[model samples]
Target: MIVTPPSAEEVTGHAASMYDRDTQDDGFVFAHTQVMAINPEAHEAFESLVKAIVASIGIGVYEAATLGAARAIGSAHCLLAHGRKALRAGVLDDDGLRAFAHHDDSGFSESEQAVVRFAERLSADAASMTDADSQALRDVGFTDRQIVDITLAAAARNFFSRALLALDVPVDVVPGVSPKTAAALTARVR
Candidate 1:
């Protein structure tokens, strides 16, 4: 990482709390969390927004959108992290995640495919997005609120992914993700 993260002993207040939460949840502090915790307020706010979006839209849908945006942005970090989340949420199996990383939408439902396409377009070229982009979501039976949450999920991934890339943060070796799946997820990153 270009920036040095605070040592565990140096972390205090909200940052310390974040470290504790990560340890409790994931059994370790994620490098991303450690780096982002450098600005605890911003990190907390961003995490809260992500939690809200996930709560509003189901984890399955959020992971689909996030994976799409991550692929579009060529973020190996997001792809691996969200791929593990998708697996844990029962949204995708190992084969399904591999297919997604390879840009094959065959394993996904029509609604999920639509969400992925929409997120890919938004992340890759938001400037060219039109009303039709949102219309696609409606066609797939997404309500306005669900659509908004999906947008938030994708946009938020872009923000966090870009920050990691900008800072040259090393991608975490996400536990529970298979090596084959990890290679597929990172294929585009190189």
Candidate 2:
């Protein structure tokens, strides 16, 4: 069955308001995330599941791979959110975050460095993935199934990030960051 598009006011009036208010509370605007304005219920459900997976796995591994992919793909949206989240996950700090912004390698462990590189290559050219790529993950002790999960995690964010970019979402979520990213995060606060 097809669900009709929500009324414009239903999204703009109520959803937009709360989203913006939350941004203000965070001192960061993320309303430009169009998912905020799409189907709220659906978005929440999808996020909940993703969070559940992260909570279960322990964030260090999952987020490193995800953010690595974000950087490879140059996704401003994912990079901003994931940068903060990674810090909060205790996977890295402000300095670490800055290093990631430039693909600097000093802040990460050798294993982490490998994972990040794998994420970058995979994100840039999943279609070109070969036995060497699989071998790299295996060398890191990731089973085939875990590698699949890592790929999914990276790809999922790609979908969301591209969607937000397509919608011309303004991000103002983190001010110390780039302007477009900040506006995309904060532009359409509720």
| Candidate 1 C-alpha lDDT tens digits along 1-190 | 7798998899998999989987887798888888988999998899899889988678888988999999999998899988998898889999999988888976678999999999999899999999899999999899999999999999999999999989888887888899999998997793
Question: Lowest summed-lDDT stretch of 10 residues in model 1?
Answer: 100-109
Instruction: Score residue 12 of candidate 2 by CA lDDT.
Output: 69
**For residues 1-190, could you state the per-residue lDDT of candidate 2 as single tens digits?**
1223333355565456546665675753354433455666656665765775565335776787778877776677677877767766778777777766766856666666777887888778889888898688779777766676666677777677666667666554454444543443333322
Model 1 CA lDDT for position 29? 88
Clashing pairs in 1: none
What lDDT score goes with residue 89 in model 2?
A: 73
**Off by more than 4 A, model 1:** 25-27
Query: Which ranges in model 2 have alpha carbons more than 4 Å from their true place?
Result: 1-29, 175-190
C-alpha RMSD in Å of predicted model 1 compared with the true structure: 1.4
Q: Using Cα atoms with residue i matched to residue i, what is each candidate's TM-score against the true structure?
A: 0.94, 0.73
